[model samples]
Target: MPRILAIDYGLKRTGIAVTDEMQIIASGLTTIPSETAITFLKDYFAKEKVERVLIGEPKQMDYTPSESAKLIEAFVEKFKNNFPDLPFERVDERFTSKMAFQTMIDSGLKKKQRQNKALIDEISATIMLQDYLSRKNF
Candidate 1:
């Protein structure tokens, strides 16, 4: 089976994650500047057989769309335009960042290492992909 890719889209940086060919495990791929995300994805798609793409949908505590949703929506539009043949879905991303930070603390990452926002973004993407896999039983 082709691998599935997940994206944690942020204003400045975007995190990427991918599943194994069998779609069993999710692993962080990279973190890139948001401005170059599409270019990065285009290259990655050329190198891998990605079955589908998953993007985190930010939501507020009341289950309403968060302010970041606008930026995400804009990005989605660009993504669709670029990869019209590719399919993509949105997964709830509420608290994924917090979870990633807590995970870092639990894993005993040093303060300096944990301060890397790019690393946090990558971990957030990994967590989002894992959550999707868990829900789908894949």
Candidate 2:
């Protein structure tokens, strides 16, 4: 069994999450600058067995590409070039960030704590991974 990695790609920062070998749960890994994400993933892959990489695909209400889709496309192309053997799957991530923020508020996070968008991004990655896992099980 290998881990499944998920990415919540953003223009500034990218959030990362990973599932255990069994893929029963997803946990936030970290948030890093988009420029640094590929380097980090390369190092991570060297030490861990990753079965698949899940990339969040943002969509508007009309089911069209969001503004950030272009950046994501470039990022994916770069990833495929760098890690040609790795496989990727796209998951919708329209409101995962908002959901993560709400979860933080519900958990009684202070205003200062809630202001950490990086954390929210990581949570969003977790949400994406969770959704992927749930859909696979069904």
Candidate 3:
């Protein structure tokens, strides 16, 4: 029972999340520079067992691909080339950021703490992972 990883990809920063081995919980892992995300993931995978990777796919209100999608696609292409054995899936990321912000607020985080973009990113990834888990059976 390997864990499933989720990625909220961005041009400057990337958010990461991972599920427990039992696939019952998804938690924020960390945020890293976009340029270093692949190397980071490679190192992480070498240390941990990951069943698959779910990347957040940004979309416009009309369901069209967002401008940031090109950046994500490029990164996904390189990631697949680098880790051919690992499976990858895309999850709709609409409103995840807003949801993350609300989560921070509900958690009683201070204004300054909630303003941290890295924290927002990580939480966004967590939300995306949770959404995927809810829709997936088992």
Question: Would you list the C-alpha lDDT of every candidate in the order shown?
Answer: 0.95, 0.96, 0.95
Report the poorest 10 consecutive residues by lDDT, candidate 2: 86-95
Query: Candidate 2: where are CA atoms >4 Å away?
Result: none
**Candidate 3 TM-score to native:** 0.98
lDDT, residue 58, candidate 1:
96
**Where does candidate 3 clash, by residue pair?**
none
lDDT minimum window of 10 residues, candidate 1: 129-138
TM-score of candidate 2 relative to the true fold: 0.98
Model 2 per-residue lDDT tens digits across residues 1-138 = 999999999999999999998989999999999999899999999999999999999999898999999999999999999999999998899999999999899999999999999999999999999989999999
Candidate 1 lDDT over residue span 4-119, tens digit each = 99999999999999999999999999999999999999999999999899999999999899999999999999999999999999999998899999999999999999999999
TM-score of each prediction? 0.98, 0.98, 0.98
